[model samples]
Target: MNSDRLFTRFAIGINAAWLTLFALVPIILILIVSFLKPDPNFFVLMHFSPRSYLTLINPIYLKVFARSLLLALITAGCCLCIGYPFAFILAQLKTRFKPLLLLLVIIPFWTSSLLRSYAMVILLEAHGILNSFLLRWHIISQPLHLLYTNTAVLIGLVYCLLPFMILPLYANIEKLDLRLIEAARDLGASHLQAFGKVIIPLTLPGIISGTVLVLLPAMTLFYIPDLLGGAKSLLLGNLIQMQFLYTGNWPQGSAVSIALTVLMSLLLLLYLRLIPKAQRSQPL
Candidate 1:
């Protein structure tokens, strides 16, 4: 028993150390950098200022923030709508082929996201497969210009972040006690009523988990917009990338990064706090 206790403590200590060294250290460094002054000639000047945070209030930066929030919200909502149904169906399936269906979901992840973005470009381009198929079918007189639009960006965001949403939801849904659903139905609840009173409450944790997974990434995935959406719109991720890589403005970049980290941390805290409450309220 003492040996087991020692092993548990040792494992927890290792995890704490790992988080401190990797997560806490990087965040502290970024926070410090966010307050530093930018220099055109140097990486950063010695002078300290809050100019980076101040710059975030600029109209252009505010616009980017708004866009990022809107896109992330929409992406999460879409993923929930898509993923919940998929996860529910996948979880409730009893066939021997269930694993094969789940494998198909995992298959897309095997390909590089960059490669998939390029594939989206090819499909979305004017002379590409989608347009060609549409044109061949006389769907339109002319090839529709689908690239470089908000719709295109949303498509890319949803496509890439969907799996993140689905996996978490699946994990939760699979553990659900289907007997509760059956009991609800037996108690004269309509299908919709049973779902509303039964499935959703139990799956609240999964919904939150999936939303966080999709929402956070949607706000910060730079390449999908760059490649698939033609860089017409900039999200927070693009803004951060431009500040650090293109403009060499590391302070502003760090500020954006810090802002993102704080936002993510808040989401995580909420998720952690809410899960227990959800579990407590869960119908037995």
Candidate 2:
């Protein structure tokens, strides 16, 4: 018992120390910097000012925020549509190849997402594989003009984040009580009705988890929007990156960062609130 208690205390201490150094400290620094005045020469001044936050409230930045949220929503929605069916099929599979198939899903994580975005460039360029195939098949008379567009950005976000949406859903669906679905069907419910009444209610947690995962990353993945959407499609992430790295405006960047963090925190709070409600509302 002493050994176990010692191990637990050691593990807790390590986690607490790590979080304090990495997560909590960074957040505190950012919060402090957000209230400081931006100095062109120093990057941050000790003088406290709300100018950074005032800048965030400008109409132009508000529009960017709205657009960023919209894009994130679309990415999460697309991931849900694609991931749900795929996860359901994978979970229902009885084949020994399941692990191999799941491994294929995870292989992408072994690679850099930067490389993945560049790979998307190759696929989305006018004469890339996707367009070339379409051209050969006479799908269209002209190259689809895919790269450096919102479409390309959306595709890239979905491609990169789909796995995040799938794994949780697969875990949830694998543990689903199929008999409940069958019972709904036997009670004169159609397939669609049974799905709505049984499968969705039980799988709500997975759907919410996957969506939140995709949504949060979609908001903050700066490189994808930069590489795929071009300057014309600036997002909150791109704005923050520009302020800090390109423009050397640390205060403004931290302000934007705090605003975005608040938005994301609200989503997390919603997740926490809704998850228990979903559990309680699950059909017997």
Candidate 3:
């Protein structure tokens, strides 16, 4: 018994050490690099400085940050709006059909996100199937500027992240006791009232989780915005990319990355405050 207990403790320590090395170390390195001054050549860091952080306050970066935030919020909102219904349906389905419905939701994730965005570009372009079909149906006089627009980016993002939103919601809604809803109805509450007062509160944790999952990735996404929104519609991700590749300013890029990381951490903290302790303690 003593040997078994000792081995268990040793294994836990080893796993914790591994996580610290792989995850914590990289984050610390990035934070350190963000405060360093870039050299004239090779964009190498020579010494620690606060100038990189000061540059983060420039109007251009601030605007990009705001735009990214708005985009993320909109994406999360749309995901919730669309995902909740599907999740509700899935939760009410027969046990045998649940796996099939989940498969349908998860199928898109098997493909690369980059490839999926490119496919959206092909589908939404002027001569693409969407426009062609609309023209054939006489829905429009001409192909609209659907590609290379913010709307296109939003469409692609929602498609990619929808599964993340739906799965969590379905899990939570499945665990919800249907008897409570039935009881509310028996007490003369309307369906809307029952849902608003009972269902929404119970499912709030899943909603918050899905929102965070979508928003965090959406804010930092570069490829979707680059492919669909075009170079002209810049977001924070694009700005960071530019600093690294176009401007060759490693320190500035690292600073932008660090700032985004901090902002996301803060958002996650706020999200945690909204969820009930019981719901949050559930396994993801």
Candidate 4:
């Protein structure tokens, strides 16, 4: 028993050390740098200043932040709507077929996401396969302007993040007690009613998990907007990248990063608090 306890403690210590070295240290450095002043020649100076944070109050930066938040919410909501039905279908499949279906969901990971984004670019272009097919079918007189738009960026976000939304929902739905759904049906609850009242409540955890997984990354995926939305859809991720890489303002970039991190952390905490109340309120 003592040996088991000692081993567990050692494992925890090792994990803590790894997290401190990689995650905590980098976050601490970024936080510290955010408070420093940027130099004209150098990226930042040793002195402290609030200029970076103050600059965020500018309407331009506020617009970028708002755009990013809206895009993330839309992407997450789209994923949830598309994924829920697909996950439900998957969860109802036979055990023998389940692995194959899951493998199909995961097969996209073998290819680079960059490559996938580029593929979208090709498909969404004016003279692309989709347009050509539509033209051949007399769907439109000319090729439509499909690429380099917010719609294209949304397509990329949904295609990439759909799996993240589906897998969690499938896991949760697969474990659900189908008998409860049957009971609700027997008690005269209609299909939609049983789904809304019982199945949804049981899958709330998975919904939250999937939303967080998709929303956070969707907020910062600059490459997707770069490839699909072009300059017209400049997002917060692009703004931060420009600050650090192009403009050579590391302090401002760090400040933006800190702001994003704090906002997401607070949102996550709010979700955590509300989830329990939501679950408890549902009639089980």
Candidate 1 matches the true fold with a TM-score of 0.85
Ranking of models by TM-score: 2, 3, 4, 1
1 or 4, greater by lDDT: 4
**Distance (Å) between predicted and true CA of 107, model 1?**
1.4
TM-scores for every predicted model: 0.85, 0.89, 0.89, 0.87
Tell me which of candidates 2 and 4 scores higher on TM-score: 2
TM-score between model 2 and native: 0.89
Better structure of 2 and 4 per lDDT = 2
Q: Write the per-residue lDDT of candidate 4 for residues 71-140, one digit (tens) a residue.
A: 9999999999999999999998877978988999999999999899999988989999889989999999
**How would you order the candidates by lDDT, starting with the best?**
2, 4, 3, 1
The alpha-carbon root-mean-square deviation between model 1 and the true structure, to one decimal in Å, is: 4.1
Please, what is the whole-model Cα lDDT of each candidate in the order they appear? 0.87, 0.91, 0.88, 0.89
Q: Candidate 1 lDDT, tens digit per residue, 101-168?
A: 98888899999888988898899899999999999999987998988887888888899888888888
Off by over 4 Å in 4: 1-22, 274-284
Q: Per-residue lDDT for 186-266 in model 2, tens only?
A: 899999999888899889999998899899999888799889888687888889888999899999999999999999999
Compared with the true structure, the alpha-carbon lDDT of candidate 3 equals 0.88
Candidate 4 vs. true structure, TM-score: 0.87
The parts of candidate 2 lying over 4 Å away from their true place are 1-18, 277-284
